[model samples]
Target: MALEIPRDRSPDSSLWLLRDGYQFIEKRARRYGTDIFDTRLLLQRTVCMTGAEAARAFYEHEALQRTGAGPARVQRTLFGQGGVQGLDGAEHRQRKQMFMSLMTPEAIQRLADFSAEQWQARAASWAAAERVVLLDEAEELLCRAVCAWSGIPLPEHEVATRTRDLVLMFESAASVGVKHWQGRLARRRGEAWVADLVRRTRTGELSQGPGQALATIAGHREPDGRLLDERVAAVELLSVLRPTVAVSRFIVFVALALQSSAGSRAKLEAGDLDPEWFVHEVRRFYPFFPFVVARAGEDFEWGGYRIPSGERVLLDLYGTNHDARWWPQPGRFQPERFRDWTGDPFTLIPQGGGDHYAGHRCAGEWVTIALMKTALAFLTTSIRYDVPAQDLRVSLSRIPAAPSSGFVMSNVHRA
Candidate 1:
């Protein structure tokens, strides 16, 4: 028997999508009393679903392909063209290997060391200032840390300019009007900037030490034995770079959680909880990306609903992370909930989930965790600061939302 998926009966729902942000699909699921629903977004038919089952199905290679899946606006900003995030099957595996190679334990430790050193140096400067916006500070710190780790030399003078540009690319990834256009501009400028380095690398005009990401990506060849276009290589580099910086946003949430959730913060201060658990809770509790988008690779059905090939589908990442069924007392901030965590990729995806090698799961998730843990250690046991009175609210309507005041602090010194 053919299944009848619930349909959102309304005109084009692009406005609703923009308005609702993280909760768009979950709101519909609640209203229709079903996890699967059909609606029109941006004047095109789309399917939206949530939960672990939905995610497992969405990531299956045969059921979905990433090529031509995302919106042009997102491609132009957040993802860039021809990066591994857009590839499928053999090509995806081949490209993904280039990225996964950089995730060795030694390399990730270097990321932690780089970020930790940068954070301490920045905190020293913050102590002299009357007030510091944590969001701004963390972004610049991460930009430099990642650049150094990747063997991309960032001149001290260019740090501020380059960091803000990268932030705009991800922050404006879901915005419209001036901000959206600014994101587009950032991607163009950033791509050109990295493309030059790729060119220099191939010609031996630039030299990078062994195991650095810049050198690895430059030398990587496709399974067909062709080098990536300079622009595409740049895109893949930014794919790693941008997300590492974006971890700063999660760091800000770490600060917020330290302030808002007294029990969790106390645990951290007492050294009773592992930073990983707190970071996991932070990833789950806060909103990063509202959803992950993909197009159907082939005809398929789940829960009796038939999905035709080429259908646009969105997995509600934020919804699934906060869903009460998977997360008991879902609204509460409790690090203890993750103590028994078995590493179910589908359940705890602040980044995309599944096998990192073959699937679209974020290649740098461990890096995000390592960096977040390092930041947490600095916050909990190393640094001392006072959270000033400000609006610390996170708006769900904003894709990749952070605190309203960017989590400002003052009076910083060694803990």
Candidate 2:
């Protein structure tokens, strides 16, 4: 009495997934002419879905759950174990609220102000250099800014090394062999670094002012009224720092758009275009997070197919943002397309979609927007630079793709 979902012929599409990268889910869905399909990945049967409709279903909180949903490699690397990402039910809501509390407009603006200061300092230094790789500089810049804002003490000597560790955590999420092992090692070191801080805060050896993210996390108590484990507290704190550092990728993509898109820089400079449109388009058009993993919490029927409880499901974040149904002329990099965007949560999710407080949508999404706007404004209004001739092609085949040359710039000067 149930329709069969389209299925991939391969015994295991794990290799294909690694090969296809961001296009794995959407390409198969396009081949089948359906938004949903079942395939074997990592030798386990998994359901992949995309498009706006599928996103809506995938975010149905009661139907899908996060616990036991993430793979071991990802858990060990990208998402530390026992973080809010793995919680569900009331516990998730409570932890999510803790994160949301830090996103108040004033708090976000304070972080942006800190980042702007970093940009100013870094840009001044760039003026003296013959050439600079924006990706590398931006990561360190955000690393310093987020640490100051979060009240995490990042000493001058440890800046580069700490930034590299945070970068490896996300950059190596989809890598293999030595690269993957490096990410695991980085996570262990980073966690230990913060866990010690948490212990110090509790023992009165360290102190941070009220409202700082580190203080908030260290003091956060569960519903049953116990402070979070020091390791989990460290993981939660890193969740704030790591994602802010990851925004450097988006900042590079912004520079790429300014260099590549015709008249985009002119429009932005002339004040005829808003930076939000530019940021939104970059997030939608480019590949950042490939997909989000979840598991069915109970048996449910969608799109004429029955999904059994415990079935692994993948919601394509990049593909859904690029889906032609929600985004007309989806392949083009037109920022104007968002001029009248309907603000559909499911459609524009480069980060995961759904309610910020209720569902699993990213908590720091507003912070991403604010910091990107800060970067955009800085690159456009406060400085001038020449993007040297280099390989600017972005490969959809690479997980967490970036320009091969890392968006090189030369002759930077204050405007």
Candidate 3:
């Protein structure tokens, strides 16, 4: 079937896709076949693709590049323009290497302990109040933890304010209308705030702390002899901060799952929280980066459709996560699927797949799993989620999908 551009300029279809995107992408792919529909955008000329092959191909395409105008526009606005994600070739590899050192297992283990300490303190306060918004509370906890680690010295009010602003920047960047402009403004403000922090740290004015590992590494040289300059270092730090802000959202989503699912809560209560199992399931089911945008680098034909060079392609992560061909009972949340299936690691990529051929995957996948495991272990065994009516709905289009009301919980009795 030939790829046909939608003649209707109405963005309702696209807007609807953005709202409940997973289901929309699934239904569309089923109707039009993964080959065609997966590459067709509902609202614009941008191509939307899914399936293992398309995803693999996009990441593997040599002519294709991630640090293009489309991505640069958003990344610069959201994560400072010229960081690793915005660079191509040797520059991108060099910057990525500089940041990778901070993600070492040893470093993550230390951070895990620190994160648990903060979680414990925050959980105590929530228990005292006997009620708290999961979203707000989680963001606060993560921001504080990140600040403590990064030596950012942000006050409670500033953390709250800046976090809200960053979240807005992400939302605006993802949405349509005047949102792009609004996102740009937020990005500018956020970049300036973070850049100043980086400057302070460099001059030794900001004391080195537990979370300052990334900043420290930013100043280090890679094995390949690549070093990150101050501006690039600042952007990399913001990249880390972006994920730090989102991790809490993912944590709350998992908590809500435990509350709502039949045996899930009971499992937590029983102290049977398997770190590997639960974390994998949560990532598989959650809408983290529902849609990843990429621009075609060269004219190519895949699945019979011709993608012109420089055209933007949006890969539906949510759609692929639920692709029946790749995952059986794709809609259901099952961690057991990964228990014995040790075949190809590429088959299941909650954090993405491949090396350079795969894509620029999340570096913190291991750390995220470890942190989530630690959080769940504490919450299930030590703290109790007592929200009267827990809400688990996700803002699908949001980059790191945060819950509408955040995960509100209370009742701190020992499990």
Candidate 4:
């Protein structure tokens, strides 16, 4: 028995999505009293769904494929062309393994250690300043840390220029006009910058330490025994560098959560709560990635509705994280929820869901957690600062939202 999915009844909902932002899918889900619905976005029919079960079907069942699913704007900006984000099946797995190889426990700890060093060093400079915007400072800090960890040299003079380009890539991913064009330009420059590095590394003009991401990606060959196109290699490298810089947004949220959530900072300061728990809550409670896109891999029936092959499906990451069925009192910020966490990948997917190796779950998730925990400990225990009265509001209408004032801190000093 085929059932018709609830439809948005509009010829196009792209404007609505831009206007509604993070809540667009969930708002309609609530109104229709169903977890699944159909809509027209950008003049094409699309299916949107939320909650744990839908995610299981989307990821685990292999009901969707990522290739050609991402928007042209996203490909030109956020993801870049021919990167792993756009691959499928064997090609994706091979590329993904190359990424996961850099995520071993030792490698992750190395990144965290590098992050802590950056924080300590930056905090020293912040102490001398009258005020510091955390978002700006954190982006630069992460940009430096990731570059050093990845074996990419970041000369002192180019830090600001490189960081701004990386920031623009994500910031303008959902914007229009000038900002959108800026994102495209950034991607172009970023790719060219890394492609040159790839060329140099291949020709021995550049040397990298063993296991360094730059060297590994440059030397990696496809299953077909061909080297990645130099441009594609650059995209993969930026795939590493860009996302690491984007973690700065989460770092800002760590600061905001400590400021807003009563007694939360006290627990961290008093050693009553683990920084890991706080970091998890910040990811689940805040908005970073709103949703991920894919095309149905094959015709299938799910939730009493028939989904046709080639149909565009958006599995709502933000909405699923806040789904009441999986998260009790899902609207509230609670770090304690993870204390006895079942470790269900589908439920708390701030990145994406499912098995990291076999599926599309983000390979950098462990790195994000390690870096966020480091930042949390630094903010709560390693430093003392005053949050000046300013706009800390995070607007959901903004894709990849952050505080309006970038969470300013004044009179900073080491604790």
Q: Please give the lDDT score at residue 46 for candidate 1.
A: 91
**Candidates 1 and 3 compared by TM-score, better number:** 1
Error of 4 at 31 (Å): 0.9
Q: Against the unseen true structure, what C-alpha lDDT does each candidate score?
A: 0.89, 0.92, 0.66, 0.92
Give the runs in model 1 whose Cα sits over 4 Å from its true position. none
- Report the poorest 10 consecutive residues by lDDT, candidate 4: 56-65
Q: Which stretches of candidate 3 lie over 4 Å from their true place?
A: 1-13, 38-44, 69-73, 176-182, 207-211, 217-229, 268-273, 343-345, 356-359, 395-400
Q: Candidate 4, 64: how far from true, in Å?
A: 0.9
| TM-score of each prediction | 0.98, 0.99, 0.85, 0.99
Angstrom error of the Cα, residue 348, model 1: value is 1.3
Residue by residue across 29-123, what tens digits does model 2's lDDT show? 99999999999998888999998888888887488899999999998899999999988989999999999999999999999999999999988
Candidate 4 global lDDT: 0.92
Candidate 1: give its CA RMSD in angstroms. 1.0
Candidate 1 residue lDDT tens string, 1-415? 7688889987788999888989998899889988789899877789998988888888864888889989988898888998988889998998999999999999999999999999889877877888899899899999999999998989989999889889988988888899999999999999998889889998999999988889999998988888888999999989888888899999999889989888888877777887789999999999998888889878888878898888899998998998888999888998999989998988877788889998999899899989999988888888888887899989999888998899889898877
1-415: candidate 3 lDDT, tens digit per residue? 6455322233446665666555555566666555334333443466666777876776676755776635544664665666665566675666566566667777777767778888788776665675787677767677677666655677766877788766666666556668777777777777777777767766777667543554565455644665656666666777777677667767886786776675866765665545577677788787766656667678877766777787777666677777778789977877667666554444556666556322476667777887788777876767755676655577555655666778767665555
Off by over 4 Å in 2: none
